[model samples]
Target: MTGSPAIPEASAASALVFVGPMAAGKTSIGRRVARELGWEFHDTDARIVAGHGPITEIFAEHGEAHFRALEEEAVRSALTGGAGRIVSLGGGAVLSSATRQLLRGFPVVLLTTTQEAVLSRTNLDKRPLLKDDPEAWGRIYAERLPLYREVADQTWASERRPKEHIAAEITAWFRANHAPAEPIHGEAKDEQHD
Candidate 1:
């Protein structure tokens, strides 16, 4: 109940990719899930930062198009990197067709939040697209909902749940629906819970 339940050794090799709108808690939930499963955790945004530069700087210097191109490349690296890991993607990571194609073989979970929740959790200035028109963030989110749905293998709304509860739900879903493959790097040991 506190963490992921024991996964049997026979489960298939698989990876969980978390996607959602800004402030939907992908990174937080992903970290929790990865910890519980004893799997590696990677964030495409973080990879983007390591590979290129800070996202804000990328957007400011080159522009949205350039930033998105980098995002696509980062996503590809994360997806093909192999199983037994949780990958958290940026809010707008789904906007690229190539990224969606790369995710085809991975189990994608969409973490969703209400528009009001999104507005409350994030400031418009930090997000390049919303800096000039804050209210437009909601509109953009509404437009992208369908796109997110189109690519999601499963959807979990994180608006009301605690992070552990959300992680538990995802863990349960993975257990019942799929098996974990041998860890691409090494076997992941189950974590000890309090």
Candidate 2:
């Protein structure tokens, strides 16, 4: 991904976290919301790529267990950065209890898309889990849906809507329910370009 402007500390710290199943438009919508809010957008998956190389490579080299550890670390760093940014997490990021706890008090939105939509948006070959069994993708989604619902403060279904529309919905939700709060732990600064 190309670099974007660094988000203000205030915006970064109060970030809206997006979580959901694969191809649910989390990353795309998150980016739109961040752009609309004039805040920074960061994807934990992207950070993982920046830190440990591509996800496929990580899984191939050290296996999923190692990759998950890296994902957890990336999530922790994004949370602790204290920027009111918009963070798009990997589909399985919420599988970790630690990650869920870390998201407490943040505006967490879950993007829900249909199975058909998911299958259409994702590449079967690139996804490690989906490559094996014909039913693996469906199985994984069914298993993870409950967990996603459990952690989400708000949920948005994005079956056929444009990403911008979904992002507008998120922004509307934020305007209505979000209460601006002072930075927790106060780690504000203009860092180098993201």
lDDT of 1: 0.77
Candidate 1 residue-wise lDDT, 44-138, digit = tens: 88888887877888999999888888888777666666567788899998888777766676678999888777777787777877778767768
lDDT of 1 at 191: 21
- The number of clashing residue pairs in each candidate reads 6, 9
CA deviation > 4 Å runs, candidate 2: 1-13, 179-194
lDDT scores of the candidates, listed in order: 0.77, 0.76
Worst lDDT 10-window in candidate 1: 1-10
Clashing pairs in 2: 11-84, 12-83, 12-84, 12-85, 13-82, 13-83, 13-84, 14-84, 15-84
Report RMSD for candidate 2. Answer: 6.7
Give each model a TM-score.
0.84, 0.84
Report the C-alpha lDDT of model 2 over 47-98, residue by residue, as the tens digit: 8887778788888899998888788788777866755577889999988876
